[model samples]
Target: MAAEDPSVSGVSGRYATALFELARDERSIDAVKADLDQFEAMLADSADLKRLVRSPVFSADTQLKALAAVLEQAGITGISANFLKVVTANRRLFAVTGVIRAFRALVAKFKGEATADVTVAETLSDKNLDVLKAALKSVTGKDVALNVKVDRSIIGGLVVKLGSRMVDSSLRTKLNSIKHAMKEAG
Candidate 1:
């Protein structure tokens, strides 16, 4: 695992950096992270929320009103809620997910931690997950946080991405290699 560069300079990155700095200064990093996580989960679980965030059909006022209601229902408040309202008002709601991800990356870098995006063919057991985490920690020599995703298209095995590095051990890749080798041999 490796930490992402803290100097991300895109629009989303700038917004995330500002929010991250604000959270740090206000001593609400954990609270803001939790709020963002909850909102991200909501975005994932509700098609309507996803549409509201991404679709440009809704005016800024409409988006702000709907987002405020959603945030209230989700129990989000304080700086996090106000920050979201500002984003909505600015018509940047569509990039909220990217902003959240960039913020998480910045926080992890600030904390001297690394995040590994691990894709597996199926969900791992808790025991397996622990072993994987241990391995990543050993390799990175830093606290490694796992962002696990399950994609059966991999057929089997796992793929791990840490910053600029990636290790692909998926069965699909192995089979493709074999197929290519056979073609060369023939």
Candidate 2:
């Protein structure tokens, strides 16, 4: 199944499982997670890195050499450093982000924590953030660690998302509803 699978469907999970097993065997799960976090940050912060990873023209040798320099500059560990080199040598760098996320999910499972991505129109105060965290914990029955994002473009109110379900109560959404209602009434 691993050999014949198309990554378009369930790539991250597969790669994460493989990496997670390796980390578990080496007793470096925490270190690996931290390393992957750094790698993910690099992927986000460097457009050139993303472009380089996605570029098909770079031979595996060139990619591996470049990745080695990047790993050294970033102070990456032996496990993570070697993993990146292997990925580059095999031309699997494009899946770096997914692998990071998937590895995080695995780490969270091991830590007995749940990950919730929360986006709001504005930054919530720490007090409000705690309230939100408590509410989510009450519902999820697990320790929730939120990934918060602020988007001022949303105008007002909040959007709470837990997995696939979304509770959209933003001012933008309310205004759109009011507009739709007026048009229907007219």
Candidate 3:
């Protein structure tokens, strides 16, 4: 089980670190992770919700109260909702979405999960995903948890990104690289 240091970076890192510590203290790491995932999904699906959180024009009170209602109706815990209110009151709601993502990454780190963001041209089959996971585990020397994505512009093959590193086997990239090489040779 590889454990990452509490040390991450930027404003997002600070918010995530605080929330992660609280979750760890309450031994509700799993539940908090789930709640954050749900929050991310809601933010992604609702344009108005995204705007409300990111827009400075909305009063802190509006954000605080509206978010509280949503969290309460969703059966989220007091601490989670309280955190949102604090972010709102401080006018840090714009960081909320990134905080949730970073919190999940940190939680995964503490849980010994190797998170990889994988992008491909088409939706992958479970079998392909399993194979990819296995191959990634071998390469990374840790269990790999994938976040799959699609980019039709990939043309073919897949582009797997892990943190600052990437494996670009995409046909588009390959073609471009070849074209560059041919022009340079000529």
Candidate 4:
């Protein structure tokens, strides 16, 4: 399952694989995925949660206590909640984001869908998202699930990573290339 994407490797991959197997066996793949998505969204939205997840200053016990509250508040119980608690107890809470991403990749593959990591200067509208999905679908011949991230540093345009291929059309890259060319000419 981890053969194609190198993102699913080492510590994160192993944990993700174990969670994936459990979700698959229990036939709660959708429930676990939704819970993980909620957790990821919370991590993105809350600075304190982000710190709790990424900072090693917090001991395992503190992280566990904090994570328990978070899971309960988010109503993310069952296998997904257990998985998070296990990760925290193992002192691998720092890599939870990667594990979630890897788990999403596994689910996407299992469903015969291709997952694309897309970065844009701003959030794309629903219409634009549907158009991009259609375009990617045409290319990959599979339904594409987009993981969209916003980075203002891109200035404009977007960058897409599909499997081993990446298309970087961001304004930052374009400007950098032009600057490099002028330097070479000078």
- For candidate 4, the C-alpha RMSD (Å) to the true structure equals 1.5
lDDT: the better of candidates 1 and 2: 1
Predicted structure with the largest lDDT when compared to the true one: 4
Residue 96, candidate 1: Cα error in Å is 1.1
Give Cα-based local distance difference scores for all models: 0.90, 0.79, 0.82, 0.95
Better of 2 and 3 by lDDT: 3
Off by over 4 Å in 4: 3-5
> Would you give me the overall lDDT of model 1?
0.90
Q: After TM-score superposition, what is the CA distance of residue 149 in candidate 4 from its true location, in Å? A: 0.9
Q: Which candidate achieves the best TM-score against the true structure?
A: 4
User: Global lDDT for candidate 4?
Assistant: 0.95
lDDT of 4 at 26: 100
Candidate 1 lDDT by residue in tens digits, 26-99 = 99988999999899989988999999999999999999999999999999999999999999999999999888
Each prediction's TM-score versus the true structure:
0.89, 0.78, 0.80, 0.93
Record all residue pairs in model 2 with backbone atoms less than 3 Å apart, i.e. clashing. Answer: none
Residue-level lDDT of model 4, residues 1-186, one tens digit each, is: 775668788898999989999999999999999999999999999999999999999999999999999899989999999999999999999999999999998999889999999999999999999999999999999999999999999999999999999999999999999999999999
For model 3, how does the per-residue alpha-carbon lDDT over 72-108 read when each residue is reduced to its tens digit? Answer: 8777765677777787888999988778767868877
